[model samples]
Target: MVHYADPSMKYKLSRLNLARTDYLFSRDAAEYATYILNTSPIKANEGRKAHLQLLTKCAAALRDILVFGQACTVHRNIKN
Candidate 1:
């Protein structure tokens, strides 16, 4: 079972369906990494490989978020 040091941490459903009960702010990528790491040992080799693949996907998602933010900023600058 998973345990947390904070008794009152907010819980939310991660993309992997695991309980994420830490962090005051909403950090999607961090939560995804946490879930993957936390569940890495469930099926030994297969689980680890799956987590690695998930990490790759997470990296891509973060990159997309960054690119979108930059695009919005550029658009705002041009509109002014």
Candidate 2:
């Protein structure tokens, strides 16, 4: 049984047979989520054109976040 800092959040976390990794963020999780989501494991029932539009939006948003986030970080460092 596992516990959480939040009393209500505490629950029996499943210890399934799976590969373990130090999922500590430090950029790993972000990059992994971005990469994995791009593959979109959930095959949607959307048609070809619809799927392409969805992917295009996802790619654009991902690009914007990376570009703008880097710019903001550099700006913050410069101000500091």
Candidate 3:
């Protein structure tokens, strides 16, 4: 029982950490996007694209974290 619980606890902690990282990434991405839109010249399409890409990456990371959480839940259920 202890061994089984240990793995589940670890997974839960990992999920929490992933969630926290995702939150920080989202905040940073939003800040960068706002900075680019507000300070960059309208003609600088490249700068806009770069900022958008960063936001996209952050979104993808969040998606992955959610997927991981789902997988962990599924695995835990299966084990039980």
Candidate 4:
């Protein structure tokens, strides 16, 4: 079961029927890939791979924020 330190976010997520934030991050990753493919000089598979990696890092960065970070904590003593 998922435990949330912020009840409001949990409630909002439940209302939206989202079990996890992966969907949002995946969508961002795809859009980032498209953006990189279209505008960046990198081009092709290399560009796509690069952008995917960047977005992965962006999503990982969210794990440090209190709101989003809470979702990833596995230990009771862990604090963002």
Candidate 5:
């Protein structure tokens, strides 16, 4: 019982940490996206593509962060 409880507690803590990390990453990504969009001087087609690529990367990073948060939460719910 103690073993199970310990594991569960650890999982919960991990989940919370992951969620916080995700939130931070998401915030940073959004900021980066804004910066790229605002400062990029991509007027040509290729430049546009590059800008879009940066936006896409930011989106992907945010998505991964969210996924990690979800996984952490799911694991946190498991009974030891």
Candidate 6:
């Protein structure tokens, strides 16, 4: 039972019986972030096309963030 600072946004998260898996962010936050980044829109019952599109978008975004984030960190460290 995790105590949440915001009562209105309280959620009871449970452990899933899956190997090598962990939760990073909330579902709502993830969806919102995806939308804000203008990634592929996953529609209900959209089939394989939607799935592929989502994967492609996710891969591109992940690469961009990792590359830029690492670059920024290196630059900051060099300056100090």
In model 6, pairs of residues that clash are: none
Q: Write the per-residue lDDT of candidate 2 for residues 2-77, one digit (tens) a residue.
A: 6588764433232221223444443798898888867765555433234545767543444444443343333345
lDDT by residue for model 6 (1-80), tens: 66778765443232342221434446667789878656665465344344556667533344444443443344356666
Candidate 3: Cα lDDT at 64: 48
How far residue 65's Cα lies from its native spot in candidate 3, in Å, is 36
Instruction: Candidate 1: count the clashes.
Output: 0
Per-candidate alpha-carbon RMSD to the true structure: 14.9, 11.1, 16.0, 16.0, 15.4, 14.6
Model 5 lowest lDDT segment of ten: 66-75
Model 2's number of clashes is 0
Question: Over all chains combined, what TM-score does candidate 4 have?
Answer: 0.28
lDDT of 1 by residue, 1-80 (tens): 77767654525324324433334335877888899888667643553454545767533444444443343343346666
Tens digit of per-residue lDDT, candidate 4, span 1-80: 88889989888888676645666688898999898768877534553454645667533355554653444646675575
Residue 24: error of model 3 in Å? 3.6
Error of 4 at 59 (Å): 37
lDDT on C-alpha atoms for all candidate structures: 0.54, 0.52, 0.69, 0.67, 0.69, 0.51
User: Which residue pairs overlap in candidate 3's backbone?
Assistant: none
Q: Which stretches of model 4 miss by more than 4 angstroms?
A: 1-19, 43-80
What tens-digit string does per-residue lDDT give for candidate 5 at 1-80?
33554658878887999999998899899999999888888655544544546667533344444343343343465676
> TM-scores across all candidates?
0.20, 0.24, 0.37, 0.28, 0.38, 0.19
Off by over 4 Å in 3: 1-5, 44-80
lDDT, candidate 3, equals 0.69
Error of 4 at 66 (Å): 48
Top TM-score model:
5
Query: What ranges in model 6 sit over 4 Å off?
Result: 1-25, 39-80
